[model samples]
Target: MGKHLESDGPSSFSRDTVKAIISQFLGFLLDAYDLTMILTIAPVLAVVLFPPSSSLLATFNVIFAYSLTIIFRPLGSAIFGHLGDKLGRRTDLIITVLGLGITSALTAALPTYAQVGILSYILFVIIRIGVGIFAGGEYAAGHPFAMEWTPYKWRGFISGLVQGGFSFGSMLTAAVLSLFISTFGVKGLETYAWRYLFLTTLIPAVIALAIRLSMKETPIFSDLKAQNKIRKSPFLDLFRKPYRRDFFQVMLFMTGLFFYSYSLFAFVPTILEHKPSVFSLSTANHIYTIGTVAAFFGAVLFGTLTQIVGRRRLALIWAVITFIVSIPMYYMLMYGASIGNVAIATIAVIIIGIIAQGPWGMIPIYLSERFKASMRSSGLGFGYSSGIFLGGWFSIYVPLMHEYLFKSIDTPTNVWFSTAVLLMIGAVIVGIGQYLGPETLGTRLSE
Candidate 1:
């Protein structure tokens, strides 16, 4: 009886662990929803703010602003990651959530371009930067927080739950936009739709803040601190020695994953919406909604698979599947034969979502396992943020390259074809990197 009780204790689920996972998941959901909400409104904003004269340029400017935010994310991660490592995860999570909530609310209240001229654009950029800083910290802090609290056997599931939040957030944003657009009309949508979308950020952010406030520091971090084993300069320790190879491996892994994700999630919907020759706005929205739902289950599936096969092998499989199927997926979406064709296209979109997004579910576990608990937050933050920064730029540049090189918008098929090729290249790199990377299954935090 004593032996059975002792054995079961390690696998038992506790209230604190559940709380930590929910808090982290909620924070991720808010961030994901806010980021995608602005993206959904970008087309309408371009017409309103830039009109016909500078519409494309306005769209590019918004993309550039988003890219800048991605650039600053690493800085936020570094700052908050250090604090989380040195002080406590709960404290850093609270700070980030509060900052994100304030900035999101402020974004909703900002003046339009007609009302404030260049100042409106300037303020928008500034707000995005503020949000970016907090967003950067939110992601880095949450993954490690959840991973630390979770039992080793269930880490993959918890990690998937954290990753799955973004897809759920995206779905929620889609549902909200669908409702708002139906009731408000396009003109009303242009004026007030974005404000409501921004307002949605407050719900999860405030909830996460409250939940985090009630939580204690993880046992692993606390134990390390008690032993005086925490690194004095976590960033320096990551880059200077012993950890550099692992850092590079993380960068490679993230770069490939981010490249696939940012392109598919951020660019694909916009491309489909703006290019009516391919699909109407309503059709595009339906596709996105369906695709996002598919991605959510894909993440959950991949997360479960990781627990059985190990992170390295699962990542390799996802990459290979994406590379092989991307062209057919793009082809179906580009040229639908009938209503049945649209159904087929929808399935293709779902498969693409699964392949493109599966890597993310495993990344938190793979990254967290690579470092000692004392420096895990900092190392993972640096790796993840750097990949986002690089991948964000790739997403921006690829479309610009398509426009410049092809010199025509009339050819929707070519544009999508180009996008698929770019994604395939990223997949190949990910597959190769996984082959070269180390397997980190069943590793303990103390290692």
Candidate 2:
């Protein structure tokens, strides 16, 4: 038998164990905040980071930066996943957080295009790439580290709560952006207010770092180390026959998950900001904030459900729901400015949030359960980042399709229709994968 360490028992946790959990949750929360913050300010970035001489280029650049970060995340995932698996999750996590914190601060300090011309845009892309690199590892390391430390019975609950931390970040970004616009107006938001939002990333970074520093490595990983079960090359092993199936299955699920969720949260904001839009920028932000609240609860609910019904079943069910409702919901969001239409839009997005994020609640534990501690981080990180990398490429098509398919028509209809098609396609892919995937509820980490 492999060396086994005691799991964190149900009743109590040592102070350091508690600190580690908190840090992981916060790390996820902050990672979400940092990534979504760019989407939050896409409207402003279009204005401040690009000259008005060509609105099309400005719009493309905004999506480009967002897509670039998502696409580059795999590089970070592969590199850090290797390090986390070989060295230690805690050690690599600290390094990743430090990189993300520094990048956010530097991004806030960048000059606007009005002040520095195209060079400003170049700097922004560079910083976003840096963010992606660090971001790639935050959850890949954090999820396995946290799940491995918890009791098996509470795994679903803890996983849901921590994954919901992402929604918390999404909600926080909307709330903060609303506050900034209220204080500064649109012009000020474009000029100075946007910088302050990037600066806020530092808060969670500091909090996560402090907690991580105080904690010991997880009991599961420690036990593996004691037995010398750690692999010399976990990254390569992920592609070998034994682990390869789970690796690709998880990637497929995430490809669908990231594609729909990113389109809903990140791309829609730009569409709502278009002229003759049904919702004003402030109103859209409010709607997103509300939808994210629903998403958090949805995540928790599904996380809980997975324990009873099984992970594969719950994922398949939600995948079907997302596919069915995605298009109709888009039509509702594009509904005209009547109060009735706005109400429909609001309810539609809230439901979308629930369906879109529900399956993610089980993802952390599910992915963690698929591999042994010897290479869990590497396997999970590469799969997660690779799926996100591929899914993110869809964002480029959003603006391109809108500009081409419906250039003469309304922009909102164009975006909603385009993104809805993408979401449906993703849902179908995930549903097929989930049907063929294994169910791993109540499995112990060291199994």
Over the stretch 47-103, how does candidate 1's per-residue lDDT look in tens digits?
Answer: 545545554456666766777777888888899988878887788899999998889
Candidate 1 local distance difference test against the native: 0.75
- The local distance difference test score of each candidate is 0.75, 0.77
Clashing pairs in 1: none
RMSD of each: 3.3, 2.9
Clashing pairs in 2: none
Regions of model 2 farther than 4 Å from truth: 1-14, 53-57, 336-342, 403-414
- The window of 10 residues in a row where model 2 has the poorest summed lDDT is 1-10
